[model samples]
Target chain A: NAGVTQTPKFHILKIGQSMTLQCTQDMNHNYMYWYRQDPGMGLKLIYYSVGAGITDKGEVPNGYNVSRSTTEDFPLRLELAAPSQTSVYFCASSDVDRGFPGYTFGSGTRLTVV
Target chain B: AQTVTQSQPEMSVQEAETVTLSCTYDTSESDYYLFWYKQPPSRQMILVIRQEAYKQQNATENRFSVNFQKAAKSFSLKISDSQLGDAAMYFCAYRSAFGPRDTGRRALTFGSGTRLQVQP
Candidate 1:
């Protein structure tokens, strides 16, 4: 079903570089989230959208931005990429109204900032 | 703020044996949910099991089960007949039942995680 798809599975960026991580879901879920996993740590929410046109910052939102213009797409933007931003990013979608049992996560985008 | 804690940073078990990964959470809300997510080398977060705070009965899925202690806010996962595929980093997560309308967001607070190693 292509639950959730994240583009650029792997990337390398130099300092001060900015890039966008694309995420899309065919499930048409209203709830979508972006999370980053640092080494030896659990995933931390970066940003989330309850639905298109409604977005909010999450626990770790610094240096990142997100937009939800359509139900199928939620993209994460990394500005001024720093070594600290070197980590794996995951996009997840869930739907309480659709009776989704739990979240369906994307494979993840592994980014390295050197 | 709600928080999840996984005391065991790492655990290992012999193949075919059983292993338990412990998780405890702190929350003031009575209605909430708990989840166990498995992340192998692939790093894809897979839900292992889930428990509702209001439900007294624990949740189970095949060889995986959770011991839900609502009073203690403790949710531990039990893996039976462990195999090589069972080896992964297990994470405990918490989410509130009510999604605040003001922000329109209900997010999961996850524990650091427990690395599970299955010995052959």
Candidate 2:
């Protein structure tokens, strides 16, 4: 079902440049999240949306923005890329069912700000 | 806020042997969820196992099982008959079970992960 798909598996951006990491899920999940994983570290939530048009900042939301225009898509935008933003970004989705809270994760996008 | 900790930064297990990865968490909420994820070279997060806080029986999936201690706030993943394919970075994550009242609190809080090396 292509549970969750992230675009541009790898990319390199110059300092001050901007780009968007795209994420889509066919599972019709109501909750979507964006996380970044630094070297030898676990994933840190950057932003999350409970549903379309509802977004909120997460643990590490600085230097980034997100928009959930549709239920199937949640895109993360880096307005001014910095070397500190170099990390593996992941998109995940899950339903609101009380029975299970597990997430379906994408393959991750590796970004390097030069 | 909740936090998960993986004390072991790395671990090694000989093929066909068993290995356990330790994870501890801090949370004030009684109802929550715990998970172990495996990330291989491909960098795809795969759910290895999951345990609900209220479930007394330890969650087991094939050769993978979890030792969940509610009182101790510990969740360890044990891999039996370890194989080369099992070598990867393992992460422990936590999520509070707050219902619709707490909409955005459902995000999983992850630990710093333990890299598992399956030695041949």
Candidate 3:
């Protein structure tokens, strides 16, 4: 199984630009999440999805949006990117039955907004 | 609300030695989960070990073990026979068992990571 996969391992965006960070999991997990990690800081959740058509904002969801149209895909949209948005983003998935078991993380997408 | 804290920002251990990373969390809920995740240079978060709140005995996996103190709200991870591959940033996370009752919105709160250096 490909477990979890994230696209565009690295990218650079200009202020006011927009882009989507793509994430997919073949494990058929019901839970998917988007988190950003700054240097020396713990990861902060931006958004999460329970299932298709369901999404919710997390602790640090500002300047970002998410949509889960299918069980395998949960994409994060950054509208009007800013320099503060530069960080390493990770896509994760897990089965709810396991009651929040350890997440399977993607290789992470490093974003730099100038 | 829950919060996790990792007191140590950086640590060093000689190769083949042992090291313990300290973690403490604040949570009112009695039932919860604690985890230690490793992020190597590759930036992949891997689960090192996990401890259930109710479990009295500390959780151990091979050379990785957790010293879970329920009352003290302390959870420390000990890595024995450390190797170069064990060098990475470790994060402690907490998840509350009680949520909106929908059960699908549960999320983890992570502490600032501790970077471990394995000296050869």
Candidate 4:
């Protein structure tokens, strides 16, 4: 169903290098989120958007940026990547009206910053 | 701020047996949502079950069920007749209630997660 798609399943970045992680969902859901899961740790929210043109910082947004210019796309940008940014990134979406607010997650992007 | 906790870092259950994973949360709001997500070795996160705060009746789906205690602020997942497919990292997550402020609450708070092993 192409529920949620994330580009570049794996990547390795050098210190100070910048990159962007792409995420798109075909569910036409209004809510989208970006999160990173560290080794042996649970996922932590980085940023989220309610709809096109609306976005907000999440728990761990300091080193990341995101924009929602369209309903189906929300991309996270990492400027001047640091070693601490190395983690598995996930994109998720949810349609609140679907009766349950549970989210559908993408396969995830395994990013490694050395 | 809402926080989710999964006390069991690892669990093992023989195939065909039952196992329960523990989860706890801290939240002041009365209305919220809890969820269980399973991440297989393939790294795809799948929703296992969900529970609504106002619903006194526990939420169950096939072999997956949740014990929801509102007063105690505890939510746990139980997997019955475990299968090899059940071996994965299970995460417990929580979200704030829906409303105009829903945008702010849209971000889910996740616990450290529990790795479930199914022994055949």
DockQ of each: 0.60, 0.87, 0.62, 0.81
Q: What's chain A's TM-score in each predicted model?
A: 0.95, 0.97, 0.95, 0.96
User: Given candidate 2, what's the lDDT at residue A110?
Assistant: 96
Please give, for residues B1-120, the per-residue lDDT of candidate 4 as tens digits. 999999999999999999999999999999888999999999999888988898999999999999998998899999999999999999999988868755688778999999999999
- Tens-place lDDT per residue, model 1, A21-63, is 9999999888899999998898899999989998998999999
* Model 3 / residue B58 / CA error / Å: 0.3
Which candidate wins on lDDT? 2
Task: Place model 1 in a CAPRI quality band.
Answer: medium
Q: Identify the candidate with maximal DockQ.
A: 2
Ranking by lDDT: 2, 4, 3, 1
Steric clash pairs (candidate 4): none
Estimate the TM-score of every prediction.
Answer: 0.96, 0.98, 0.96, 0.97
Order of candidate numbers by TM-score, starting with the best: 2, 4, 3, 1
Looking at model 4 chain B, report the run of 10 residues with the lowest lDDT sum. B98-107
lDDT, residue A112, candidate 4: 95
Name the top TM-score candidate: 2
DockQ for candidate 2, please give it. 0.87
List, residue by residue over B1-120, the lDDT tens digit for candidate 1. Answer: 888899999999999999999999999998888899999999889998888888899899999999998888899999999999999999999988874453443677899999999999
lDDT of 2 by residue, A1-114 (tens): 668999999999999999999999999999999999999999999999999999999999999999999999999999989999999999999985687776899999999999
- Please give the range of 10 consecutive residues that has the lowest summed lDDT in model 1 chain A: A93-102
Model 1 chain B poorest ten-residue lDDT run? B98-107
Q: Evaluated on chain B only, what is the TM-score of candidate 2? A: 0.98
Per-prediction CA RMSD (Å) = 1.5, 0.8, 1.4, 1.2
